[model samples]
Target: MASPVDTPRNSPSPSPEPDNPYPVETVLTVPKFKRGWAKGARMAFFEARVPDYTSARAKGPAQTADYLVAVSNAYCQQFTWWLDPPNEPTASDLAKTDDELDPAELQLKAAKILRLRRASRNLLDRLSNSAPAISKMTPAQIKRDPVSSLISAIANGKTHVPRARTAYQLWSKSQFNKDIKTDVDQSVIDNGVDAKSGRIRLVTGSTQQAFQNLPASERRVWELQADAEKAANQEARGLQKKDGVIPAMPLDPTATQDMLDALVHKIDPLLQGISKLTNGNAHFYWAGPEPRRGGQINVISMHAGVDRMPIPCGFMEAGGSEGVARRRTVEAAIGDFALSCYDPKVQAARTLPKIAPCSAPPSFLRYRPTTWDAGNTESPSAHSQPSTDNGLISPPDVSLPGNPTTSSNQSPSATTSKKSSKKRKSNTDAAAPPAKRHATGVRTNTNDEDQTSDDEPEETPWQVDDDGSGEDEPANSQPRRSGTRTSMRISTKTLPPQHDPLDDITNTVHMSSSDKLPSPEIPDNVAGAQLTDDDTMNEGLDTLNAPTTPATASTPVSTAPFLSNPTIPADLPKYLTHVLPKFETLAEPAWQDVTKSFVKYEVSRKFDDVRLQTGNRPAAAVQWSRLRRPLITPDKLPREMPQTVKLAAEAFWRWWRHLQPSWRNVNASANALGDIDRNITEEDWERLDASGANGLVNVMGYLWLWGMKVGVSGEGCQDWEAALRDVQWALEKMTAATNV
Candidate 1:
């Protein structure tokens, strides 16, 4: 017998039919191997099953094409099985009877086996059709057979699963926000895989440019399609979105090659600016969907450290209707600012230097209000004892060495007597228990109201100035003696010297170790006198002194003042800096204006409102004129109105009036224009009413134009111009509708 490859070209076989031309089971010979067969025997068995396609080639080109198609289909079926193999039943599964097993499980198992059988038949069919399975064919065998070589190339080539149909359907349903069925059908034709060549058809430059000129909704369709495509491809390859291996956004037709390259160049500078503003605590990068490649500029923040993680900031798309991109950019910047406030690293960076200074007490030592000040002045003994106010313990009559009460003019005998008397009083106070002192309040008057009235003094409490400037004293020099004995003032006998007492205390407390002061003798009657050490007392006093130098020299006096500052960072992109300020002071109100404008434009443009046409005075315009009469007139514009806003409003009015020649009389009432018969469906009316008012759109439209004018300049100006042109085109369409 001749070898399979050397078989005669005209050998008799079943005639080929138009459909199901190649009978796979009849023509193919399955490879059979015994359990004990060696590797060589198995290899020879597979070689013997290889197909002879010489007979089909001898018939005609038509027959040959049919045969190739059948062979390709068979190979695909076999490859499917190789990708996912069927699971064999285990011993435990075999032990279960039909009744014991779940019907669903049994059905699933049978289905899997059926697929495996089909795969086996196809595997044999490929061998009969001059092509062995890819796994069985050697490199040398593949090169010898053209059919096998083609199959090998196809199997090994990059796998591009045609996901455009799935992607387009999902994208349209979620984001298209228009006639879903119509747009989906259109997208399949425009961006889907070519039927002839199983590959995505490249969009031509002219088609792309035309798409850029389309309406905002239509443009968004293409942009979303590109994003879906990239996401699908990434998922197929098990690639992460942040791998930075982003696919090019071919469907964003507005962003040309030059524009995309410019955006790429801008990334480093933009990120650098953000990093500088955040003090290296935050990092920005392009990521998400097709935004990384200029479909939309998604600026994501990552914590700037070893374990960097993605943070949801905001995104800006390059193309949209007028003011859309600018609005999105400003919103994104604001979102980043807000999110950064809660970020641990960001907050730490902002406050690290100020922590110690802000937390430390004020530099000047002064008396603060205590618990006794809250109308609880009733204790006599508590008032006479050394007060623990502000954590300082000093006897009532104990005066500093330099104080006038302890002046050098006093005789030594008199000073000794005063000191002896002070020691005796201290011993008596120490002998008294704390509980007795707290209980010894003036309870003679039991009436609650009388006690409150007597205790609550009309005059401010007396405060002694530690610096001896007497600035803390009340206007009346003579101290007011209140009926309540528990006044907040220190005894007059223990007045501080005419200088900063803290200075002397700090010197005495922080004295050199070698300069040991003599310890004073304690009386026998004083409790805990033996436990008190002068060194320990001095150490405790040291803590009372305020820090001479702040913990951080560079610490700001105020904390997080940026939270209140209206000014934006100068290092930010010029577009952001220019546009952000306009919305900064009136962000919420401006956003409301933008939303109203969008609704008004959509309603008027869709319904073809004749009142908004160039020749007719719109109701919005008349209302605007009436409203502006007081704030703006021929003589002067309101001072509160910005120059930019005034100029923008004026320019928009001039452009609106002259947009088209006015055949109608200038004196025609806006009410007359509204009276024109027009077919508006119930749904359309609902949509129109849902839009609320129209005047704000006209106001915001002018402001948006002014912002776009100033925000973008140079080469970057083209994008904004294209956006404005879209708005102009929509308005022109509305105008043409009226003429019709």
Candidate 2:
């Protein structure tokens, strides 16, 4: 229970009263919250239910981010159960946290909002490109299947995919267009758009680079393209003289980048529905640097549960000299067919149980140290873990009900479970999968080692070091990171020295060039090299066809273990894999109702008298047999399954009602209250009957399944590229099929 102080706290303030009163002025002084006020406000502005995203704007000599100002004032005082101490960045803090800003600082909510916005713009741009070239095209063309349109565009070398575009474009492209002053989208191709005589036209050689795949040069090109596009758009409008033809304008390559992130904000609701559908919330996160790297794009789409963790469904790389060239393709490449949006595969249950790593450029794995808790402990800076296995490294269920300590043998052992259930009858089989992907949003294709190799040194195009000499570092001294912005530097050895001697990377013998000096002696004990010949031979064997290992391994392992990726790979850029996933994790809570429910549950029942008077059952117990169904008999109990089994199965609901002790008096007081209507979605009740691991998995599964139904879904397997097409198809088909 934290209370605020009237005095502004520059450092640690005196502890507040236990009342944890939501004091207006004093609570705002909490140091932990001070840092994130602006960011939180921005998130809340969009997250809070509203008539529209923006508030009414008023003219002002001094403009401010209304959202940020509110957050700084509201959450500034005490630390909430869900929020860690404040790390809010102020204008001055931004100057201090310039280059060294930790990527982790840009939490999930912020990241997701960014992803949503970026993705929306990117999707629109794509649709703009593939729209009917002639504004007055036939209805058939205007209403062509979006997924098919995207596929056709991809197959026919069209510049972009067709997703949901503006209604103006849709109507104008249709034969019905007459006097509507619809503007053509120059960022994307003007497919069926009638060549507006007064508009400017621009040429753009676009590429779909993976969020993590683009080189720095390519990323910069993307940024420049975005800025230039903005400039072009501004100039185009102004170019309209009394009677001139449309100005010729080049397209903005940046407009279609993988920055496909969520522009909208989603806030967690207290006592809100848990395990809601996942569709309308699919978002793409672009990892940010410490100093406010950038925004993410979001969407709602169906995805293979745990399996989706292994595939970067929206990844692509192209046309950049450095950094990442491609922007995230939100729902593209999945062949987003309208009907396919209802694909049975989209309904399957799959959850990695936790945030997992994206298996992209090998370097991204570094952020997820082998220990799931490494660098994530209460005292993150104090813990320095030794790097061990490259294979998945699961952790003890630290977030479980009990204080799951770092020590292992005393962890969630099978022995404790048997002892706890000794008095009760129990039997079980909760199978586990072979390996789990990390919470990070990266996945390397086991079948596509060549994908990593395609951009290798041999086929390499432009050199970051324009001079033939690969010495990219400045002749004088390397530039120090000022804040979040740092110039790109291509490492000489893009791939880690960890390639197996027998794998595709095994072509170890390199021709020593007279121009290039030898690198330092390769360490014999390098992790990749430490493996035995047998291990090297089986290089990708662990991921390619790893057998599913049952979770019933006597001890429950936290599913999303971090990988210790050591260095950046030349072929892969750091931004895509190295930094993006953290943003996703921060955003996860908003997309769902985890934290809010837990916080609310903590404060519930503890003092609520209604709960005391009426325990779990109603005052009078109605025969469950007559009301619902008869309980399983003792004989059947042995065979009956459990809906949920705890691994790290730890969380909560409304606290004010649940924890507080209630009065036993039969007569109710006027002040007596009951926290009713704990949101029970269809997904919830169905999971109620499920026991053990099935419960958690199925709950998450239904959420995702429903999500796809609402967001990204199509009939069959949606490859990364075609998914967006399906989304467009779904939106359009649904829109057209509507009687409106």
Candidate 3:
């Protein structure tokens, strides 16, 4: 079975459209820079696009360059300034007037054309610099060659070539294609020479012969140009034009390596440290919503992996948002992005966070509250005062919310008398049973009045032994609080609902009532076996009434009973060795079962029809749910299920899915190692748990179902052929179960 990851080395070539021999021209539209602040960058970019062009390679060497001159004239004539200069009325007579032109739009159009022309000049210059043969010629000599003009026009965006009709198509995979092979044979190409004109003219010849006439240096230049165009076309496939980012004003191509280094350090201080730590180079890069004028420019740490990948430090800049403000915003966003990468649960939405104004600290710098209880410490605040027997502190008398205000006419003596009376009432209420007062949700002694002083204990303190023993002793033998707080009656209606359908179906564990209770403390007297018979009986009764503790999730469960018994023979089957690795890894009985299951799945598959039924997904899902329920439900799981079995089962299930055939054979479709369909993308896999693809169950639930049937040790056991066969059988079973 071929997975989606298996892509064809050579994709089918698109059929060619009818060719137009004549020159085709269309109106070119230029867009205006809507942003006011990016005007400086825009102008700089346009200036960089203007070229100092020469016609060295455009004309013949001695008679001078008529063809080269014509090509240059044609290139310049496309722009408005060349056709209709503002300074000359004669030049403007045929051109669009000011009323017909948009100033911003016209300016942008000129800049774009200038940039494209400059790009072509740079390409030629680079080729000349690299080849000594070409370098020896002067700019004038090179520009006189007709080949240079045509190549430049293409790079400058003045001309376009359909990719399907490119000359390179005649060269690639030439060994496998006769047409491409014949196209490159120079001897075969010379047969078409026109005797009288001394010009080459051929019929039924390869497209590559058109370029074979050029000098070696010039031919190499055309090859490089075509290669670049081909690469751009490949990269643009399956992507929309809007997806691309036009980088902020590009750095000067003439800048020295050292200058770039200096620029990087100036922009980001953190990258300097990162470079030293990683023992790799650091450079500036950009990542944002887009690579246009307002896109973020940040320093990325480039360290060597199998290949180099930039590890960016959070830093960014936009138009008019440079210097300190951009750095801070980038830092904040990068912090969260880095931390999220470290988290195992943070797999959703892998796109980088967008930069914006931010005051929040990065993850590493953010304030985090310590969860440790301060009251447990040996500090003075922890044990300031001794607690009372009733667990109530009789506070100093204070005016209650219900009390009437003292009149202004009253003297200080009268106010003092009222406070004294309130104190007496508070003391009386404190003496009453705690159960009665707690039920009323009210206190006679006000909260402010009950505040303990710095010298008093707030909570009961444990006693340290005077003899310097390391252990703590019970403090003053105070009776400990125990049992459920039953005094206050809780309405059933007020309590949140207990039965959640998701939790029940997914087999999620919830804390039982007893699990929520505080563990009962054993008194020092009980440790010494000083409990009376009645005390022993009461303790036994409490233990009996307590809810059972749920099984520990980490503890390994054996899977022998659930799986078919392994068949361990004197000579083990080759497939068994592949899946199990070492025979000793599984017990004799378990190995037998592993062998048996493999045999069962393989032999049974031959009789089963393996037709794919994509539209019957609902029926397959229903059958899958029924099959998986026993393995997933905690109570119904086999007692012998072990961790090893679970891992092996998971690997097996994933391997099976990867073997499933693709439904659609598009360029973007490739199967993943564990995907049931070729359509699932990396993004879909990340959110598989959240998506209800399997109807009622999630990925975890499905894994758990298979996991309970088999277990093993180490990473995971795999049998490529076995898994493939199992998938074939599974598809058949699924179809039968669906009655399709």
Best by TM-score: 2
Candidate 3 lDDT by residue in tens digits, 1-740: 10011111112323223341111132554333232211233333332322212222322221112222222323343333323211222344335543465666554444444433333344434432343323333566455553433332222321122243354443433321344434434434466554223222232334445447547886676577677767765554323133322111122222212223222222333344556687754443422211111122222222111213252111110111111122322332333244334322222122123423222222211111110011114233323121221222221111111112122321111122222212122212334424321211111222222332333332212111112111122232334344312122213332322222122211222221011111111111010110011111111222212212211111112322323234322222212211222122234343344434433433333323222211111112222322222112322333223234433353334323432333322222212232333333321211111111221122222333333233423233343223333433433343343333
Query: lDDT of each prediction vs. the true structure?
Result: 0.29, 0.23, 0.28
Poorly placed runs, candidate 2 (over 4 Å)? 1-74, 78-234, 239-661, 664-740
Query: Which regions in candidate 1 have their CA more than 4 angstroms from the true location?
Result: 1-299, 302-706, 710-740
- Tens digits of per-residue lDDT, candidate 2, 429-493, equal 22532222221111111211211222233322111211122112221133343322112222354
lDDT of 1 by residue, 675-699 (tens): 1222221222121121112322343
Model 3 TM-score on a 0 to 1 scale: 0.16
Which candidate tops lDDT?
1
Please report the TM-score between candidate 1 and the true structure: 0.14
TM-score of each: 0.14, 0.19, 0.16
Instruction: Report the CA-based lDDT of candidate 2 relative to the real structure.
Output: 0.23
Candidate 1, 345: how far from true, in Å? 27
Model 2 TM-score (2 dp): 0.19
Worst 10 residues of 2 by lDDT: 526-535
